[model samples]
Target: MTTAPHAETFHSDGTPDASGRRVGVLLSHGFTGSPASIVPWGRYLAEQGYAVAVPRLPGHGTTWQDMTTTRYDDYYAEIEREFDALRARTDVVVVGGLSMGGCLVLQLAERRADQVAGVVLVNPAVNSTNKQLLLLPVMKHLVKAFPGIGSDIKKEGVVESAYDKTPLKPLASMVAAWKQVRAGLGEVTAPVLLFRSAEDHVVDPSSARIILDGIASADVTERVLAESYHVATLDNDAPQIFAESAEFVARVTSQVAAS
Candidate 1:
């Protein structure tokens, strides 16, 4: 399948910090959205001398039909692969993502608590209140997909490279995976930095609430994005996301070194 423009994976090996301990950040994009959505954020982290890895999930960055052939595990395996590689190269690693990607990293935080130093999320989605989704199991058998939820950016002229449709099978797989992620949330003890948009059409507020309530992290912080939508990483408040995440990485990595 031909990949969409700007949808390729992005990676950078950064310089070591002042303490000579290298820090890495692994970022993931949203469902149906490609690395194009978060590569700018990854670039900003790399500029701050932090190793960065942004992997393209399976069945994504291509036609929506291709997504139907893959499941949630397929996407997450790609994330885990890049994450392990980053961890091998750096002294400590921080994981973050947008929407579904955010949920994936949360899974990593829960399952690999001993390895993950910190967690960052932007409009992460674990649960949805959409009534139509209740029939996903049956609907997925009857229909192949629905309209796409890409490019929910508030900024004018900014377009995210994403699929034009939402594949039902993959969506169902993701929703099913959410149950496991939620069940394991309390296992995540690393510091967390969560960013939620005040207005997001694709993901409702229930996800943010669930994450905040379920995670056991004592140093959890939630910030509200007033000017952006679901795809905040590519929206008007992108500069803030980049700068704050850089600061967050430094603070969390320093804490790791101190211990």
Candidate 2:
């Protein structure tokens, strides 16, 4: 199967800081999706001189069938590797992601609260209100996959480079990770900026509500994307996500510097 060109990993060699410590941002894509979904946002951060890493999660950027072989631990391992690399090189690190990517970053924030500078999430998916997901444990044993939940963009004619099918086993693993992360939300103390699309088909508003209500971060900001859907990073309100994320990194890092 031929993958879309945008699905490839993106990297930007932003200028190093004068103080010999870099400022970096790590952007992760959603489940069954590649970096293509968030490349524009990463590019925006790169242009502002923040070293950006958008790694293709394991089992993604290839094919849906390939994703079936991987589990959520493998996906989080990729993000953790990227996070460690950035933490070593940068003085302050800001973590951001799209959907499952957002959940992964929250896990990272919970584990590395002392190192993470800030957090940015666009339509983050932590929990689903859909009752059908409750049957995943049993259904995954009989069914191998389900219809894809990708490309939920409100903008016309735009397509997200994501898997056409959702692998039930991997999805079950993802849901388990979501539960683990959600339970630890109170441990995340970094400044957070969240962008929730008003009409998302894939992730329910409860995901955002749970995050906002659970996280202990006192500096939490939520902006509703009026013109987008689940993939707001690539939808009509993408510019808002890009601009606000850049501003968020700058603001939080400066605050750290001052403190």
Best by TM-score: 1
Q: Per-residue lDDT tens digits of candidate 1, residues 77-188?
A: 9999999999899999999999999999999999999999999999999999998888999999999999988999999999888888999989999999999999999999
Query: Could you tell me which 10 consecutive residues in candidate 1 have the lowest summed lDDT?
Result: 2-11
Cα-lDDT of candidate 2 = 0.91
lDDT of each: 0.94, 0.91
Model 1: how far residue 230 lies from native, Å: 0.4
Give the per-residue lDDT digits (tens) of candidate 2, residues 155-217: 999989788899999999999888899999999999999999989999999999999999999
Instruction: Supply candidate 1's per-residue lDDT for 139.
Output: 96
Record all residue pairs in model 2 with backbone atoms less than 3 Å apart, i.e. clashing.
Answer: none
User: Could you tell me the lDDT of residue 253 within candidate 2?
Assistant: 89
- Regions of model 2 farther than 4 Å from truth: 1-4, 17-21
